[model samples]
Target: MIKKNIYFVPLFLAIFSFVVIAVALQLDTSPEMIVGDSMQARSFPIFLMILNLILVAVLILQFYKNQPNPIPLEKFPTWGSMILFLVFYVLTVFTDMFIGIFVVMFLMCVLWGEKRIWVALLTASITPALIFMLFDLVLKIRFPRGILTNIYYG
Candidate 1:
C-alpha cells in the first residue's frame, strides 16, 4: 500500500544515514592542537551520527505504528521514479554537483506529479542554489564545477 511505500523512503534514508555514520566513524577525527581541543575533527561526525541514530529510531517507531494501517497502492507513484532517482544519483557522482542536482530535482518533481512548471522550476533551481550557497559560501566546502563551469570561465 501507499503507506508501506512511504515508509521505504524513510527506511532508505535511515540506512543511508547509518552508512554515512559508519564511514564517518572510520575517519581520523583526532583533534589538532592548532585547531584547539574544543574543535576535534571527530565532533561533527559524532554529532551527525547521533542525529542519524535519533532519526532512525523515530523512523522505526513510526514504521511500527503505521504497519497496521497500510493504504491502498493506487496512490503511489510509478516504480520507475524510484529507479530514475537512483540512476540520477549515481550519475551525479560523475557530473557537476549543481547541474546534477538541478536536473535531478526538476525531473523528480515532474516524475512525482508536480503539475506547475513554474513551481517545479523554482523548486529545482532554488533548492540546489541554496545548498550550493550553504556549502560553498557558509561552510567553505568546494563542489566540482563540471564542464559547463570550465567553459563559462574560459
Candidate 2:
C-alpha cells in the first residue's frame, strides 16, 4: 500500500501562514498616527507577521530534518481550543480584546479541571484587572474598551 501524503499537512499550514501574513501586511492603520512610541502603528502587525513567517520556515525545516512519524494528535481541547480562539478572534473585531481574553482564559481554566466554581470564577474575574494593571499601568500599553468605555468614563 502507498503511504499517505502527510507532507501536505505542513504545506497547507505554510500556505495558510502566508495568507495570514499577506492580510496583516495589507492592513490600513493610516487613519491615526501612533505617538509616544519609537515604532509606528504598523510596526506591531508587521513584526508579528514576519515572526510567523519565520516560524513557519522553522517548522518546515524541522519536519524535513527529523522526518518524524505522523502520530495521532491530542484530543480534547487541542483543536477545539484553536477553533474557539479563532471564533473569539473574529468576535473581537466587533467586541473588545480585553473581554475576549478574559472569557477565553476563564473557559480554559474551567476546562483544565478547575474543581471549585467560586475559585475558578474569581480567578477569571480578577485576571483581567491584574492584566490591565500589568499591561496598561506597568507596561504602558492601552487596550480597547468597546462599549464599556462609556460606563467606566466616570
Candidate 3:
C-alpha cells in the first residue's frame, strides 16, 4: 500500500507541471523587450515546467527501479511548510517582502530543527539584506513599496 501511494507524489507533480505549461502557453507574447533579443515572458516558465516534467519522469523511473523504504507521513514537514508559506504571503502583502523573507527564513530554520538561535537570526537577517543589495543596487530593480522598502527607497 505504501509503495503504491508513493507514485502519487510524482503523478501529482507531473499533472501540475502540465497544467502550468498550458497556462504559460496562453500568456501574451508582446514585443516588449527587457533586453536585446529577449525571449517571451512565458518562455522561461514553460521551460521550467518542461524541466519539472522531466524530473518527475526520472523520479518515477527511480521508484520503479528501487523500491525505497517508506517514511512516516507524520515525519514530513509538508503542512508546516505550507502554513509558513501562507504566513509569508500575508506578510509580503501587508508588511513588506523583506520582512516576509526574514521572518520566513528564521521560522523555516527553526522548523527544520536548527539548534542555534544565532544561526537562525543570521540567516533571517543576512538573506534579506543580500537580496535587497542584489536587486536594488546591483540589478537596479525597484521593489514594491512597503514598510521596510519605503525607508530604503525614500
Candidate 4:
C-alpha cells in the first residue's frame, strides 16, 4: 500500500540517525572548560541523541500498528535538498553565525523555496536579523560578529 512506503522513509532515517549519533557519542572530546557548570557544551548533543532514539522507536511502532506494509517513497525531499541542508548546518561551523544564516537562508529561498522574490528576500534578511537580535540583544549572549555586527552593534 502507498502508506506502507510512507513509513519507510522515517524508519530508515531514524535508524540511520540513531547509528550516527551513537557513534558520535562514543567519540572522545577534551574538556574546553573545567568550571564544572551544569551548562556544559557536550550536554545538548547527548540529550538530543537519547531523544532521537526514543522518537524512532515510537514511529516504528506506529508504522507497524497502522500501515500493514508502509512504503515510504511517494514523497521526495530529494537527496540534493538533504545534502544542501546538511551543508548549511556544517557551514555554521566554519563561519560566523550571521554570515552562515544569511548564506543558508538565501540559498534556501532562491534554490528550493516557492515564495515570491521579495518575500524570499525578506525572509533571508529578517529571519537572521531577528535571531541575532534575540540572542545578542535579548539574551545578551556572545556570538561571532560577522560584517553586520560592526554596523548593527559595534
Candidate 5:
C-alpha cells in the first residue's frame, strides 16, 4: 500500500516541484525589466524547483536501495526539531528575524543535548552577527526593518 512505501515522500515532493515549475513558468516578467544577461523573475524559482526535483530523485534512488533512515521515526527530538522550525518562522514574523535566529539556535542546541551553556550562548550570539555581516556588509543587501535592525540602521 502507498502508506508503507518509504519513497512516497520524495516522490510526492518531486511531483509537487514539477507542478511548481509549471506554475513558475507562467509568471509574467516584462522584457524591458530584464537587463542584458540577467535572470528573469521566474528563473531563480524554477531553477530551485528543478534542483529540488533532482534531489528528490536522488532520495528516491536511495530509498529504493534500502538505505536506512538516518533519523528514525520514533525519535522525539527529531520531531521536536521539525516543530521548532515552525516556531522559528512564527517568531521571525512576529519579532525580529535575528531574534528568531538567536532564540531558535540556542533552543535547538539545548534540545539536541548541548551540555555547555556558554557554547549555546555563543552559537546563538555569533550566528546572527555573522549573518548580518555577510548580508549587510559583504553582500550589500539590506534586511527589512525590525527591532534590532531598526536600532542598528537608525
Candidate 6:
C-alpha cells in the first residue's frame, strides 16, 4: 500500500538540493573580464540552488499540512516510468545528451499515451536539436563529449 504521507518525495528533493547547493558553493568564482561586475557563471547555479531549496521547503510544508491518504499500490507503474526517466537522464552523462533526450522524450511520450507517432518523433528530434543549438551555439556552453561525440568529432 502506498502511504499517504509520502515524505520520501520532499525529503529526496531537500537532500538533493542541499547536495547541489554544497557543490555549487565550490564552483570557481574568479572574475570574468568581458562581463565585468556582471553575474558570474556560478551565480546562475547558486540562484537555481536557492530556488530548488525554496521549492523543496514549500513541498515539505504542503506534505506536512495535507497528510493525504495512501494511493493504490497499482500506481507503481507511474513511479516506475518516472524512475526510468531519471535513469535515462543520468545515463546521458556517460553517453550523448542529445541522444538521451531523443530516446527519453520518445519513450516518455509513448508511455504517456501519445497517439501520433509522427508528432512524438518530430518532437523528440527537434526539441533536442533546438536545445543543443541554443546552449552549444548561442549560449556558448559546451556539452560533454562522450564516446559518440569523440568519434563524430574525430
* lDDT of each candidate versus the true structure: 0.72, 0.70, 0.89, 0.69, 0.85, 0.77
lDDT of 1 by residue, 1-154 (tens): 4355656766777778777777877877554666664766656876887797788788768777767454556544567567767767676677665676778788788888899989999999988777777876899886665754455345
Where is the poorest 10-residue window by lDDT in model 1? 145-154
Over 4 Å off, model 3:
1-76
Q: lDDT winner among the candidates?
A: 3
lDDT of 6: 0.77
With a 3 Å backbone cut-off (N, CA, C), the pairs that clash in candidate 2 are: none
Which of 4 and 5 is the better model by TM-score?
A: 5
Ranking by lDDT: 3, 5, 6, 1, 2, 4
Q: TM-score, each model? A: 0.44, 0.54, 0.55, 0.46, 0.56, 0.50
Residue-pair clash count for candidate 3: 0
Tell me the tens digit of each residue's lDDT in model 4 across 57-111.
8877877677765334533436556666777766666655677677667766766
lDDT of 4 at 106: 74
Q: What's every prediction's RMSD, in angstroms?
A: 9.2, 9.3, 7.7, 8.7, 7.2, 9.2
User: Stretches of candidate 6 above 4 Å error?
Assistant: 1-68, 73-77, 151-154
Model 1 residue 137 lDDT score: 82
On TM-score, the stronger of 2 and 5 is: 5
Query: How would you order the candidates by TM-score, starting with the best?
Result: 5, 3, 2, 6, 4, 1
For residue 138, model 2's alpha carbon misses the true position, in angstroms, by 3.5
lDDT: worst 10-residue window of model 5: 1-10
Better of 2 and 5 by lDDT: 5
Per-residue alpha-carbon lDDT of candidate 2 for residues 1-154, written as tens digits (9 for 90 to 100) = 3224556666776677677767876776553344554655557766776787788788767777777677777887787678769866965667766667767777777777788878877887798878777876789875666654435443
Model 5: how far residue 95 lies from native, Å: 0.8
Give the Cα error of residue 10 in candidate 6, in Å.
12
Better of 1 and 3 by TM-score: 3
